[model samples]
Target: MKKYALLILFVFPISRTAWAQSPEVLAIRKYGTQNADKMMREFAAFLAIPNIARDTVNIKKNAAFIMSMMTERGIKNVQLLAPSTAGAPPAVYGEVKVPGATQTLIFYAHYDGQPVNPAQWAPGLEPFKPQLYTGTIDKSGKNIPFPTDGQYNPDWRIYARSASDDKAGVFTILSAYEALTKNGLVPTSNLKFFFEGEEEAGSPHLNQILEKHSALLQSDLWIICDGPVHQTGRKQIVFGVRGDAHMDLTVYGPKRPLHSGHYGNWAPNPALLLAKLLASMKDDEGRVTIKGFYDDVTPLTASEKKAMQEVPSVEAQMKRELGLSTVETTGAVLNEAISVPSLNINGMQSGNVGKMASNQIPTFATAVLDLRLVLGNDWQRQQQKVVDHIKAQGYHVIDHEPTDDERAQYGKLIKVIPGEDGYNAQRTPMDLPIAQRVIKAVQTTTTDPLVLQPTSGGSLPLYLFKKYLNANTMTVPIANHDNNQHAENENIRLGNLFDGLETMTAVMRMK
Candidate 1:
């Protein structure tokens, strides 16, 4: 039989109370142990498929695979939920109903993953090929062979795209129901599973899909299974998620590239100009300096503030692990910082570097800006603020590239292109009765205190669920914090994957 690590040994000891988990919970673990060999093979094969939202062919394959799993595990009415737009990636839907259960929960997780750059991944890993490692690759961990016996080390990790970011969520939710039924533990609440295929693309079609299927998707709650657990390895229940928007800004220089030595210091460099403009958007303390950036923020409620107070401080530990002696916010902690809006430059480009080095001055500088919005912050309004700030800084902001006449007329010219798919932030009340039940359901799986967060720093289109379906949502994330989400060499720890089985099982059986 396989031995599973219930909790990290160094993080928190198992409480006498947690160790006395009910018989149903114990049965769930046993099922995972006794079936690790067969389950691991199925999961590994699923991870081998490429699931980019724009790759229609491969994305459809993923949906078909999920439907097969649902059917084999006893889900009813499994189908692809399509939007009005043709060829858009669809959501896979299925459900399990109980005889007299009045309450229903729609479990949500995205099956799609962000696009990957193969060269950026570490030498030992590839985005599509799933590989096992003894520990984190960054910690001098070595690759290991998959065991043939029904045994796995909780410390081992599986590296692949979507392994943690959400496929783990889809796998866990489906397997949780399997555990319950195979062992004779019936769920108390009706269960539904929704696997979205376009979430990483900002969920551009989600609103339409929800509007088209309002009646079919009705539920008392939407338990989101994305993001990561607490950095301390404790489970977390998030009440809200930040909204997301992107801006593409370009600064114009010369009409053509100029030799640096021939016109050195004579011609203005757009790269320098762009850097200065970005630097002015924030202070040394990291607060966005744009006027009215914080003016629209909503203060936390008394209950929210009290819940925040109880959250364990992870700043010091985070800094030590991240190798930083200073944080951008002077006095605010991590939880307090995420409560407000933020601006970040995801990437910048001006001229070639390294082996592509050249002595010519580039004709333009471009940057991709990411804006994270908290409650009361509209994605459109937040983007406009940045545009307005640029105008106030003596530059002429245009939606199109500057013409020769306009370029000569204005000393500073920039083209500001805004994203069309941006959405605002959403938060469900922490005091809601359903929220309390979600908290308790996840708590039965661990001895450590469950982290109750007001809002996660990550951005999801969860607000659309509220806007289109008139329903509230909460989050129960299962990935390890260092899962390298949306980046290269992404992976999920074996223990987090196993623990998630019990957590979702408890939620499915919640009263």
Candidate 2:
């Protein structure tokens, strides 16, 4: 529902064949150490800003702060790329041209974050206060004052919305550029920085922004610095991302709440109707039973399949960590499981629960559904499959509330309203030359072998880059696997943040 997919965080064993660090990585790490406090404090201050995309006033404040960050870093041609859609969140863009560079690379990340409910965060933490914790909050992490001295623990985390998904992306990439510039390490390729402000909002106006700025956004590759690294604590460089789509569902019952004492057994309950409908979509094994739900997925390439096998087996560990004896996918492992499409119930509502429970049947029931897509799946078509399945279930599916006459005529009625922000999946070939170069650059940043993933288990509108600019994209994630992204008490470990710096700088110094 809320991206319940968990990444494996078991510490990966380093082998004798560990990556050899380059001079650039050494320089970047040194620079990061010297400036770690300044970086965290700056990032913490930035995180203090409310960054919900729909909050125009506060969102603007975030943009201004990022622009200042760019200007201060000496990134030239800095500007906000606004879409034609008025009031839509604007993307922050800037670039640095290397004198003899022949190629351009866009370092992509988002500035906005998932909406938060302060009450949901654990005690001693606030979404915007940016508390420094000794470890994850739920594990008895301790809260301590932000240190003025440069001394700090790399394992310590800064908990805040977007701390990991992915204001840290902005902080990491920009800080890499700063480290390089400050240390006279000129980038080998012309570097462009683009930060979307509404990725968490599903990048609804991303198309408009790309349409308006296609010329300025051209790049040989877009190295997306989002999501998390391998669950095994191994550095990973993913070549693709899944797409995402969402919809809201409503099933009608009696015109008004009916007292269970009088109408219990006689009155139709919408909650049961909605529950049955959802159950009908998925089988006992958790596979969506909706016809054609998996029909359009593009099978992974042989190389991609091989890469997945090479990924550490975290299935058993993940299940244990999650306190589950079994997983939804009966036979497949975690990596194999997420490579396909998925149907998730993000949130469901009936009448009331716990203290609010009442002996009455609700007038209606509602649910928000999240549909994740792969390369061959079309967002619009995928949504239609569910709608079709509902019809197959004998529900009179409508897009809005049914009129009195229509309601009386149909025994089962439901409303299906899909969001307009849906987008398709995108993946770059794992063997492309640019992809190889990226893998090499990232590999230089750490001694642990780089995990080459076919697709991240999460979603992003990466396909739009190909649709608009014919650009290839890859992801090099930085957040700790258990950062609690898109949920309460989100965080980014200091080590991951600083490692991300070296990774970006390595790409900047790519040969």
Candidate 3:
């Protein structure tokens, strides 16, 4: 069995008293250090379980494991909140009510991960078999054997599916609670844990779960532990998240694959048609050209504008790291670009490539489109605009495959399949009392200033929280910005995980 040690490297200078710290912070650090090896082993055990939301059998196993963790920590009301739809993954719920505490805060994190393609992973690493690396794989970081003693380098990273996107959130939140209880430090507010099981699947059934458990989930606020910290390596408190919707588009070329040479000019190429269609949606500068795409975007508030301005300039650093000469010209800055609605091509497919390539035109080409919504946009309306744009391009649009007669009549044939459910964007005021308390709590742990942003570029089903529970929500992300979330070789830096433990502890101890 391998052992790991926890190394504490405080980012800012502080007196000896700072090393002593408050009981909660001190306890978290102590517990994390003393049990570093045990924690790593336990985390590895949890990460080994396949937790794709669509995989019902495996997802339940993850829920059961989490329930055991919470129950062992002496959490009350630890149970699964299942949705009405059978087989849908359930949300694991637990609570720790502090006596005489007036405020109740729900800490949320999803356990399910994005679907994986094993072939896409690096040569030696697999998604579910968590491995320790000296650093990220992109920079020639090599896989290292797990430490046999209880000492670990904070710079080391653990790569596995959901290592940073969310399983990290689950482990950090529960571990923080364990640290508090072990040290006999009672939180100032009542704490509730809600571990979602289907966030990566667009949270299609989250509203159902929320509606069914509204009364039990009532809380003053929800602190979402997801996403990455600011690119500048500082903690961030995001007030909002963009909305999300996806579309599947298929354009037909012929009833059957035709030889490119024999029917060169006679038969149209679906790949070329799909490419042209996608090109029409974006201009040379990468702005979406779809009608009404930007019409619904709401302008930022004065405070939000100030927050945006205060954000450190990380564009140059990011460009250098990403090896990019320039970014999209649509927005003045990365922060501003995320604030507006945008369209993206998640993926596209037409026939095969490489050794499988053939000298024939594919029967059809398909593309998966992602639409990100801002505050004023409606998900359904946003999707409709894209469908309408396709129609305006002189194509015959259908929800399903076209008949032979119809295909023969129309010069261009296409199909658009929109996603079932999509929630709109949600944002809480930055100046709210609860928001300020959260800011202050997080600030206590770090000497550097925290990044306060109006919104994150990513989407969360936070709007459902507002609609069903009317709860004020804020995101305090704790993973490294370069954690490679949702991509192959997903990982969480040991330092980020340790810092997150301290951050969550401080939030629970908020006054």
lDDT of candidate 2 over 106-138, digit per residue (tens): 999999999999999998789999999887777
Residue 41 Cα positional deviation in candidate 1, in Å, after optimal superposition:
1.1
Task: Give every collision pair in model 2.
Answer: 8-231
Q: Output the lDDT of residue 274, model 3.
A: 96
Model 2: how far residue 337 lies from native, Å: 1.2
lDDT of each: 0.89, 0.88, 0.89
> On TM-score, who's better, 1 or 2?
1
Q: Report the Cα lDDT for residue 219, model 2.
A: 92
Clash total of candidate 1: 0
Model 3 lDDT tens row, 267-353: 999999999999999998878899989997888999999999999888998999999988976457898888989899999999899
Instruction: Return the TM-score for each candidate structure.
Output: 0.96, 0.95, 0.96
Tell me the spans in candidate 3 whose CA falls farther than 4 Å from its real position: 1-24
TM-score for model 2? 0.95
The ten-residue window of minimal lDDT in model 3 covers 10-19
Q: Candidate 1, residues 1-511: lDDT per residue as tens digits?
A: 1244422231222212244267776788778777777777888888999999999999999999999999999999999999999999999999989999999999999999999999999997989999999888989879988887566767778999999988999999998899999999888899889999999999999998999999999999999999999888888999999999999999999999999999879888999999999999999999899999999988899998998998889999999999999999888999989888999999999999999989988899999999999999999999999999999999999999788899999999999999999998989999999889888888888767899999999989888889889899999998899999999999998878878898999998887
Q: Which residue pairs come into collision in candidate 1? A: none
